[model samples]
Target: MDTHPLFIIIDDVHPILITELEKSGITCHYHPQITRNELLTIIHQYTGLVVRSKTPIDRELIDAASNLKIIGRYGAGMENIDTDYAESKGIVCLNAPEGNRNAVAEHTIGLLFALLNKICIANHQIKNGIWDRNNNWGQEITGKTIGIIGYGNTGSTFAKKLQGFDVTLLAYDKYKSGFGNEFVRETDMETIFAEADILSLHIPLTTETNNLVNRNFIEQFQKPFILLNTSRGQIVNTSDLVAAI
Candidate 1:
């Protein structure tokens, strides 16, 4: 009986992961486009599984992975995986929480700049031959107040990225404290609502946070503000958000 591990990667990842695992004598089967039904049929054969946001690792999938010893998420947020049940079954759940922190932070900054400068709107207008400079006059970030929710990897990185922007930064994390620095003032939701000119979300999706941002939440802001969400879409109620906008 060979005790060597057999791994199945059901999502597209960097080739380096495959090369490194194969170097350690582990056999890898890469099926980036495997469907749920197809995965169910073959999951029992492997001892390790690698996934992204594509599949839901619920009870049904876990039960099918009879030989699964470990489950590796290629990104942060284990919300898609049934981590509790997997742990109970002696399965190790792993994730690279910091893998794309910088990337997400930079992307958030880019989106903020775009929104403040009306870049997308201007581009669309230009393409349609409607370039009116007066209406498209952009706002500057230098004097704005940015409110960041969730002080985790991406959140902290984003705060760091805004250091030299000369903007007042207020961050609120329900589960964290004492992370305030020279650039970011660790504060509460009320202060954020009162002062923020821009709001950004970087939290995960969980039962407690599902539809966390609805009409009532939106109405709490003291003034009109730009909203940025880099987290899970479910965190904000789509219907409520659309209606609010």
Candidate 2:
């Protein structure tokens, strides 16, 4: 008798993944809208699992996956998945951190330009028949100090994108170092806090990073700065951010 591995995909993914997996004799069963209760009912039947950020792969779900061998996260950020618990059960956890690096970097640049130029505000005013160009004057990024936290995939790509601009780039990564180049200066948080005119966060959400940007963190900056957060929302304290704003 011949047996094949069965994978249950609970989220929508590119069709190429299914095609490639099927080519290797792996059976892929896609249930993009399956509920937690429904998944729990038949989880033990599949040998592999795939998901995006919609559901949390918690202890209960891991326990229910009796025959599960691998858990594939379609995107970055493993906070939604209980990786430690899954690994304890000998299940391999995987994620595509670099999959959307360019997309995120480009979007961050678009947001930066929109914020500096007040594009959204201007658009809204124009739509409402209130064209106030005098008050909506924009700032230039030519000589601003840009601070970047976390110098991984998206962070490095963002720095690369800013190379053409005549702005100072300072990046700090607690887990990495010695990556300084012509465009980016690898530095410390103290220097960034003292010099940065624009701040960007690219780190993942974890116990230490949860609410990392609070009132105290915001107050350390020497100047009022524009903040860009493309990572998890939980990394910033909502009330504190509102108060700061």
Residue 134 error, candidate 2, Å: 0.9
Q: Model 2 lDDT vs. the true structure?
A: 0.96
**What is residue 243's positional error in candidate 2, in angstroms?**
0.9
Residue 59 CA displacement from its true place in model 2, Å: 1.0
- For model 2, the superposed segments whose C-alpha errors exceed 4 Å read none
Q: What is the TM-score of each candidate against the true structure?
A: 0.96, 0.98
The numbered model that scores best in TM-score is 2
Candidate 1 lDDT by residue in tens digits, 26-137:
9999999999999999999999999999999999999999999999999998999999999999999999989999999999999999999999999999999997999999
Candidate 2 has which clashing residue pairs, if any? none
